[model samples]
Target chain A: MTDRAPGPVRRIFTGPQRLAPHLAALSESSEYGRAIHNADPPPCDAPPWPEPHGGTPGTGLPRPDPQRSAGQALAVVRSGALTTVQDLGRYGHAHLGVPRSGALDPPALRLVNRLVGNPEGAAALETTLDGCAVRPRRAVTAAVAGAPCPVLVDGRPAPWGAPVRVPAGALLEVGRVVSGVRSYVAFGGGVAVEPVLGSRSTDLLSGLGPAPLREGTVLPLGPATGRAAPVDGVPTQAPPAELVLRIRLGPRDDWFTSAALRTLATRVYRVSAASNRIGLRTEGPPLERAVSAELPSEGMVTGAVQVPPDGRPLVFLADHPTTGGYPVVAVVAERDLPAAAQAAPGTPVRFVAVRHRSSG
Target chain B: MRALPVGDRALLVELADGEETAAFHAELLRRRAAGVLPPVREIVPAARTVLLDGLDDAASFAAGLDGWRAEAPDARVPDTVELPVRYDGPDLAEVAALWGVPAEEVARIHSAAEFRVAFCGFAPGFGYLTGLPARYAVPRRPTPRTAVPPGSVALAGPYTGVYPRSSPGGWQLIGTTDTVLWDPARVPAALLAPGTRVRFVATAAGR
Candidate 1:
């Protein structure tokens, strides 16, 4: 495949220029733009379209190693809790029941990838709670972002958020987070696992891509090309002390009693230990249903806050099933999900209802 | 049909039943293929609803859905997948008894019927097939098995399915097949996608 990056024309459409007209129109029609203007701006860091494996073409970034060898790999010395390979995710396959699996903290993953000079959507290791350790076969640049964790090379302290070069065969250890639930560790060329349906992300629900890391696993790395981003430590979001999720009442909101809706908007809920990649289960008063009859299985989406028989709401996550029988009371806005991912068990969660944004 | 807004980017259109869902899904696919349908990331059909997700403007799109009708699907031949099976599951006798047929007749009865995939869920490539008459519908096992081996042809309610992978299931297994239901290496991955016709051909017992 040609390694050409997307030209300037595509960049203009994706950047501020495209949104300028909308902003201008909004300013002219003040009353109509109330809802639309209040909506959060689309994340600027993400490309408008899915980036193909190897590199993000639209970013005008250089492709990682064209002549990468199998010898350029890492040996897992310590596989911490639930470490898995992740990228942006596999998309457009929910019709066949495939889950869109990817890094929970997408911006953090992108930051780490940038620090190591890899594309934003390149595959990397996502460690749960405790971090992991690996020994590179060849000296390579690596960075850790998301959930603020300590970095060590051969037991010596290393920078956490900036790219650090480790010598060949040196043990690069990612220490447990002082807080937060997950952390991302990215290498210069990114993890070079074989892609399944155009993604290297491990789907825990559908059991796709590579399995969770185990001690003694060997992961191949692509060739390093461009230089790491010239930067010191980057700023990162801290784990939420009190998780506040902005939600839009949903397609099945009518199924719930009015009292339930009030409870959802006003009550305080805690993050349950049962939460995982599938859904963020909550510990709180169950929402009373207006319609108690069973709902025939219907398509479920990421961010859907589905309430089961127990009445507690569960917010669907990246690896959620494509369909479900439970009624969805609301959907959390996508922008707030990275904070939800880092919410540790017992963290207080408050769901605030928001008016759906009108089309811009 | 009623289209309800699902968040900012999706609409769940409730249909009358499975037949209506299939027809509506077909019409949506036709419109999409013709580039007339609104931009959507996924058009997923389930039991009695079709979810149009990742819409550019869900409210307007949902408003437009009121005027839409379920068109009769074109009579083009659908893709057919033939799976060879051995009627030798541990629950074969139990299923035969439930069907009020002889043990051997169960295989013949199952092999004679044609099936069409209605929807896929539970796992990737695991299609919920609709073909058997309502009378042939069987209840799920009283208790689920800890592990139902992959390729086990099973029945539950009015649906027939083949386990794509080893998973804990409550379906009544009447036979076993060697066909690979899900292979990520294969293009499209799923051997039996929604709307694909399927036939189970009875084969000799040994591997």
Candidate 2:
């Protein structure tokens, strides 16, 4: 009699009982979910992420089929504190005074893009402390990563890090971050803004690419080339409770006194409210300088920790100028900058000087 | 010449003066164009220093610098841009007073000297040009203008520049030009990249 029962009725009774095993396998063998969680620390000698690929062809990495166009659009409902379209970044134009502006928390943006089956360098929306909301003209798969935050679709609770399908005209709201300072939102196809200098990133310093999102902004979407990843969940590193930055001292270290160097390494500092895309300013004891002469403007890297006359340290970020006049007493390691990007104003910061790896 | 370590992937090479900086920068550019330079991300020159960034091994590069010599840049003709300017700036009279000459003389003196882009900074496509003698250098405005019109020809310290766009600036404006100094749509966007030569030609349209 039980075997003869209709297949639909029998499956309903057994499906609930069989869910645990499927869930277990998902957590155990999900490749897309585990890749970032188990990834090794980037090599110290590796160039900063989103390396300048200006005028270069596509990354040649496997990408979703470009023929499948997702002719849809996203209407911004809430712009939040600050939201900008970003991709990996613009590179190779520093000689023209162009900054390599891109996502500050690149790993987060990359992960979100991956969840949506977009190229890791696909353009996405980077929101500040306050999250944003958008309504898609067509149903699409989307993912949000970076600062942990509550996500809502049409006012109903939704998963934050996993890809979720939003119905056409449904409101996808990224709530204020529960922690951390920024969040990333990616669609199956990236935002289709016109590229400037080989990137879609909005460089606040040089005023390149698209402008910051406005409430009524309408953004075009590229075609969705692939299906979203099958993972039910993604694990992300927790935002640092006490931001610890690894740094290498030099170039202009001789300008600072030995005590100043000690102060930088040992003293506790907090992120300043004045921080912006150009730099992460710190509020703490000023470093004393041995030489007071003005530094001739010189090329500045993304992670340079420059010291101004105020004696405070200003760590250059993605949107930093290609050249600066202030002496850079040290430079934060590139890998550490992702965490720095997520650090909110007033977060405690510690700069730890790491010795250069001697040639083996 | 001094090559100092900047973190793990960059070096700041300091030269004796602006001429030396230009010469060294030109040499680096020549090597890079010839594909003899090691892979590098950027070669940025400033007043007295050149920054080499994104090197595979900054230490090894710095070590190699001891054997390198910067030849006086080749005397080959450089890319030159001619900007026609109308001497009708609000500060033209003040600049004339500073030069101890008539307002008309200010335009003549400025238009006569040839200039070279020393460096680029402050904003994209904005070049710091050098050619005027140190005695002719002018001080920046005591208080910068909230908005300097685009294409305004200006001078401050040892550099002469044109506003690529309307932005806050302190340079003393001496004239105006219609030439676009920067346009992203154009290949090689900046009209005055470092080492490019420039000349200001007086337009017959205005005083």
Candidate 3:
């Protein structure tokens, strides 16, 4: 595997109707935002691996040995919080028993890139529950998207959505759980990690590739060096109580009885404490299947609602399993993933069925 | 043939011929290696379908089914893989007790024949190997385990498999081994691919 630096990953938003500019804007780089556009890195060592169930604390955000950097771009993950390298996801190998696990809130990940003027698909630090203390090795523009974290740069409060710059050796801190569960921090120079399988996201379930960020892991950084585009704003946490996630009927929507579908459509489902990125388990009235015949296991996409014998439908989030036997009654649209990702445990979540396609 | 839009570059093809799914997937793999597709990221072959995702559009891609469905009817399938396992797990004792048979006899019946990796699912690394010996086959536990160890040999319904990783399961464990069930780092991650043959061997060591 050749060790080449990668290009800035392109982020594709599903819709043109942008929601209100988010609270925290990503800081790709001040003025000249192009520093985040990375070059297409040549192939590196990507071996087939075991499923990683959970990220090891020691390896959470940093690499033991500093990655070979391509340009002057350098960033350091600081103390506290859970920050992991996330690309889109590990794909194709699902048949080989890999989960397409990555960002639970993709829109946030994409927005993080756009904020810093980086391509959306670029690997960024996904901070879950808690965020990290970030330090830039150089004066580079960066942005924070997704979760409602009270961000401070060098002891001064930093705005969340728009891009901001940190001088070399400056201390950047992000406080936890202002509203949502996950936060994405994108550097003007995208965070650089060796791609395992097809992505940079650490597959904790498949015990393959680099571990999640750990202390003393100074990650490799990439330099895009692109001209700054006019910055659009970032999206922040909406009113948590009134968040309504959009849903798309699945191919197997007929598997459930009409009453069951109606109950799913109208009844309130509460996010159980067991919910996480792997999948969201809900506490709701148990669903009953119309037929007892076991359905064949099939491929699933993000947002699939699969029901088991117990009738509890698992709303598969970003790190969901490859395939499932439960019939998927519905799927949450891309537009609604942010809200779904923000569904705090025990948060009352109500599913409303809608006829929406991916309106890219 | 139906073309479902995901976002832009990706497309899903619903194949009616189960045999060709493998064949078309091989063709796509070759294409992927050759750099013919600038966008495709994933090429997923399911029971009777294939979903083509452009690397650039995986997040939001469209599946061009009309062309792919017509083209996939006679594609060449990939080769099958075979697997070996020991039909023993922790739950083997309970299953034998419920069936009024000794664990040794249970092992004999389990090793009697072969199975197929008909499907892969459940957890990340979990593969469904079908075709279990009728006598050894049993219903899943009424109450599932909160967590089952990885590489656990188990049987439930007409299926026998090794748990890829520790996960909640209802299958009866017969034995355990170090052989990884689902390893992503290894090529062909699932040791037992669909259409692959599987035979259980009784060994002196049972974990």
- The DockQ figures for the candidates are 0.26, 0.39, 0.22
Arrange candidates by DockQ, descending: 2, 1, 3
**CAPRI grade, predicted model 3:** incorrect
lDDT of candidate 3 over B129-205, digit per residue (tens): 65665555577776667567777887776677677766556777887767765544455455766556576677766
- A best-first ranking of the candidates according to their TM-score comes to 2, 1, 3
lDDT of 3 by residue, A1-360 (tens): 000000000011111111113313221112111211221222333322322234211112222223435333444555343456776676666665566777777888878777776667667887766677766676677778788788888999888887877777787777775877788888765676656555777544443444555445576666644333466555564647844666765556667788988888888888765565566777889877777776544566667777766687777766665655567777766677667777776778888876543542
Regarding DockQ, does 1 or 2 come out ahead?
Answer: 2
lDDT of 1 by residue, A60-167 (tens): 233445366556899998877567788888878898888888998899899899999887887899987778899999999999989888899999999989999999
How does each model score on lDDT? 0.79, 0.79, 0.60
Question: Against the true structure, whose DockQ is highest?
Answer: 2
- Fraction of the reference Cα-Cα interface contacts (below 8 Å) that each candidate reproduces: 0.55, 0.52, 0.23
Which residue pairs clash within candidate 1? Answer: A65-A223
TM-score, prediction 2:
0.87
Candidate 3 error regions (>4 Å): A1-82, A136-140, A203-218, A223-241, A267-274, A281-289, A292-296, A308-314, A343-350, A355-360, B1-109, B141-150, B165-170, B175-181, B201-207
Q: Rank the models by lDDT, top first.
A: 2, 1, 3
Best-fitting candidate, scored by TM-score: 2
Cα lDDT for residue B141, candidate 3: 72
Tens digit per residue, CA lDDT, model 1, B1-207: 988878778889999989888889889888999999978988899888999899998888977887886566778988789999998888888888898989898888889999988888878888889888787888778767767888999988788899887766778888899998977666657888887899999999772
